[model samples]
Structure formats: structure tokens, C-alpha cells
Target: MTRITRRLALGAAAATLAAPALRAQGTAIRIIVPFAPGGSTDAVARLVAPGLTQRLGAPVVVENRSGAAGAIGTDAVAKARPDGLTWLLTFDSHATLAALLPQLPFNPDRDLDPVMLIGGAPYVLACKPDKPFRSITDVVDAARARPDAVSFGSTGNGTIGHLTMVLLQGRTNTRITHLPYRSGGLAVNDTVAGHTDMMIGSAAVVHPHARSGTLRTFAQFGPQRLPALSDLPTVAEAGLAGLEAEAWWGVFAPHGTPQDAVSRMNAALKESLNEERVRATMQEVQQARLVASSPGELATFLAREVAKWGEVVRANNIRAD
Candidate 1:
């Protein structure tokens, strides 16, 4: 071939390779929440979607692909085209599931790239108002005294709430029976009805019951006490240090998404998390703490969380069944 013709062919090949990157810049983005609508993951995704849409100049949609302990929707995001148009907004459970479930269709760390950490809320240990326990120590004492008699309810067997209880048992050296329910709402319902001894869940879910005196607040699983629920002490303050578990949510895109798009999304998320309405709504819904983090920070956080929960799951022998 002539040199001029060969050079033209090389230029055409480079442009062809760049075409996908250009197309990705103009596509609408879809944030997939691997759980049912109206949950924390979905709520956070919706809250941030508008801002992202505005920032990226593309329609941002939040889709709920709930089921299989969140594996179903997560797999969907993992298998989606790596063109940066589709993403996943889920909680720490996604990371835990990667470590706990050997059959996960997609490897969270390998198949997905972290975008941003939206925010999180500490799990509150609450009980029926009429229950005898008044503090974390009291609950521990009772669990120690009664063994399997003191049972706690959670969203499901392998959920963060369930694992939080497992960590509690491991730390306190107490045995408390777990009563898994279909959802956090159901678990909270039973806790309020006195059917379950107590429940560990997001502050948003338990705050209303505690305010209404249907459930009594014992302790929160966070680094520090929440502002709205200042009357309640943290697990550490209640004499159990180093026990912090927050229901964290974050955004992730399929691996191989352009770095430019990831950076843009991260910037938008950081801005959205700081918005007054977003903060207020999160507080109103679930008393969640607003934490916007960069992609690298979120990746490190997820890795650490995966390791932390892996130990808890192994020690507790917790499973999906």
C-alpha cells in the first residue's frame, strides 16, 4: 500500500477506537438500585439522580432490580455495557455479599468500579417500650442471662442488620437468637409489637417508633451519637468500643467505564450530598448522616468493610438460608 493510504487507514482506525468514548459522553445514565423501591438505596439514588442529570446533561434514571439478597440487580449492573451509562447504587451489603456468597454472578471488586459514597446512618438497637432493657449494657446483660431467649429481628439472614447482631454477639460474648423477617419494616413492626426482643436497623426506620414510645432506643452503631437522636448513646459509649456499623450507600459503575465519566459522576454526587434539600430529606426519611466521598476513598472503604464482614459471617455461620 502507498504510505499516504497507510497513514489514512491508521487515522481511521484511531477514530473508530475513539467513537465509543465520544458516544459514552452523550448517553443517558442509569443508576440501578439492587433492592426494592422505597428502601434506603433507592431513596438515595433518586435524591442524587436529578443533580447528576443536570450536571451531566443527560437523563439520569434510578431503576430498582430487587431480589436474591441484592445479587440480582447487582449482577445486572456488573453485566451491563461498560460504556458508563449504567451504574449501581447499593449498600455495604453488596460488598459483604461478594465475600459471603460464593455463587455471586459478578465479582463486586473486579466487575464494578466505585464512583462515590453517598452517605450512611448508624443502626439503632431498639426494643418495645415495655421491654426491660434500657441500655446496651442492659441488653447485653439480658442476652447473657437468657441466652437464646433474647431474640432480635433483622431484615433478613444475611442483611447488614443481621450481621450487626452477629458482631454484637461476638463482641459481647452473648448468644441472642435471630428472627429474620422479610423486610426492615416487618422487623420493626414485630419489634414494636413485642413479638421480637429488639431490632437493629437504620435510625430512620426506628426513630419514629422510638419517638412514639412504641420502641425504646438503647444504642446506635456509629462512631458517635447522631444529632437528632442525641438522647441515645453510641455502642462505644455504652461500653462497647470499636463497634461501628453504618448502613452505607454508594454508587458504582461497570468496570472499563471511562475515567472522565467516573470523575464527572463523583463530582456531581459530592455536590448532591451537600445540597440542603438532600441533607434534610435524608434526615427526615432515615436520620442518615451525609457523607460524600471520592472514588478512591470509597474503594478503600469497601475493601475494608468486605474484610470486616467476612470475619463476622464466618464466625457466626450466617447464610442466605
Candidate 2:
């Protein structure tokens, strides 16, 4: 594998499934986000739940079951009955958790079935507005000057944000103390409250804060600049070549779920994502490009992510906290 070649799995998602099952009618459908509320994962779940409720003729509920870098809640969905009523909406951490927790209770690949690849967004590294940072050079210099004295917060230990910062520190030969939180919102709050020197999170979590002047962004962890953030510099542009990392979100159902149920859920998801408000919110508010993908495509992408990030976890000697 040349640099573990990978790409976002996407396909011409069929707008309508062969047969839309009415199994969920009048039943309360639960969409479980395996992270704390106020984060991107929770946001995406809530955004689509209403539309899903309408489309499926069921009362959709979003639930937060946060802990253990998303493994606890994920494991819940992994072991849930394949009734199509219980689904999981997860973050980038989902792909990397198995690499961190070897004794993870559930087989991420075998226990849960992919429903959709919601989308991906670049990680944004930023500091509080009052911090002394004009560019990535200053941040790097500070970290080099005091090594682990400079601290950065992330959603959790094995989250892509945390690993991305780890990769950044390694590439720059710096040591910043890792401060992992239960969720992205908590991390952002503490960073803004002057509890941490810097923070890195998905565009969905950090973009709004940066725009509001609560935090000052320096480097975007994307290969190129996005339309919404054209003014910001890419990590590569900051002189750290090949330092790209994008946080992704997706939906999944318990393994052994009926094919008809999966197809019906997928169709509802595609329709919910196609809504104009959802499209604009995803692209503008979250700064995340949406990829409402087919189930097969999401499965392929999940496999690729597991392979790629698992290597990073081992190479970095990343242990779960």
C-alpha cells in the first residue's frame, strides 16, 4: 500500500429503495449518538431525526450515551437487536477506537452494519482569542520552547482530533500535553474558558467558535483550503507537508438487520440529507461537505478508515486514556 492509499467511499445513492418498509410506523425510533451532546455527531443526528421521523412515520429520538472514547455507546448499538428502530450516529472516533482499546467488547466491523457515510470535515487547530498566536510558526515555537508545558485539548484520547495533534507534534518534534475531554463541546468550552492553550476539533465543532472570535484559528488540517475558509492556511501551507486529517461522521445499524429495513432507512437518510436546510447547515454552519452515501459505500469507507487509522495508532504508540 503506497502510503495506505484511501479515498471517501461514495456512490450514486439510489434515491428510493426497492421497497420502503413500513415496519417503523408508530414506533419510536432511536438514533443514538455515541458522544456527549452539543458535538457534531449529536448535531447531525438531531438534524436528520425530524426528517427521518416524517419520512418513516415514526417518532425519532436522539439519545446521548457518552464515554470511553465512544466505545461504550457504540458497543450498545453493536449489541442492539437488529430491529431497525435503534441506530448509531457516530464520529471519527468510531473508526479509531478498536485500535486504541484492544479488548473492545464488540467487533466494529462485524457487529454493526453501515447505513450511510454522512460526511467529512477537516480538523481545525486554534487557540483562544487572547493567546499570542499569529501563525502556526508561533504555536510550534512555543511548543518547542517548553515541550510538554504547552497543552492542547481534544474530544478524547483516540479521537481523530487527538491523533491529529499527536501526528502534528511528531512531525514538528514537539511535545504538547494531551488534554482529552468527553466531547467536542466540552473541549471547546474549556479552551475558550482559558483552561487550555489550544484545541483541535472537527470543523463542525470549531468553525463556529472561530467565526465568533471566541477562538483564533491558525492551521486547517486539510490538503487544501475550503470555500468557506479560503482565508485560512492549510497545515501543508503552514510548511508541514502531508499533515492532513479529516474528521468524519456516519450512521450504522446493528448487524443482521433485515435488508428491507436497511434500504428503507437509507432512503429516509438520503431524503433528509437532501433537504435544503440540512444541505446549507452542513456546508455552511459545520463547514462539512456532506456525502450521503450508499450502505455498501459506507461499509467500504469504514473499512478503509479502520485500516489507515489503526496504523497511525500503532505507529504513534497511542494508548487509550
- Per model, state how many residue pairs clash: 1, 0
Candidate 2's C-alpha runs over 4 A off are 1-23
Model 2 scores a TM of 0.92
Please, what are the lDDT tens digits per residue for candidate 1 over residues 212-236? 7788888899898888888889988
Please give the RMSD to the true structure for each candidate, in Å: 5.8, 9.5
Whole-model alpha-carbon lDDT for candidate 2 = 0.87
Model 1: CA > 4 A from native: 1-28, 212-214, 283-285
lDDT of each: 0.81, 0.87
In angstroms, the error of model 2 at 242 is: 1.0
Residue 218's lDDT in candidate 2: 79
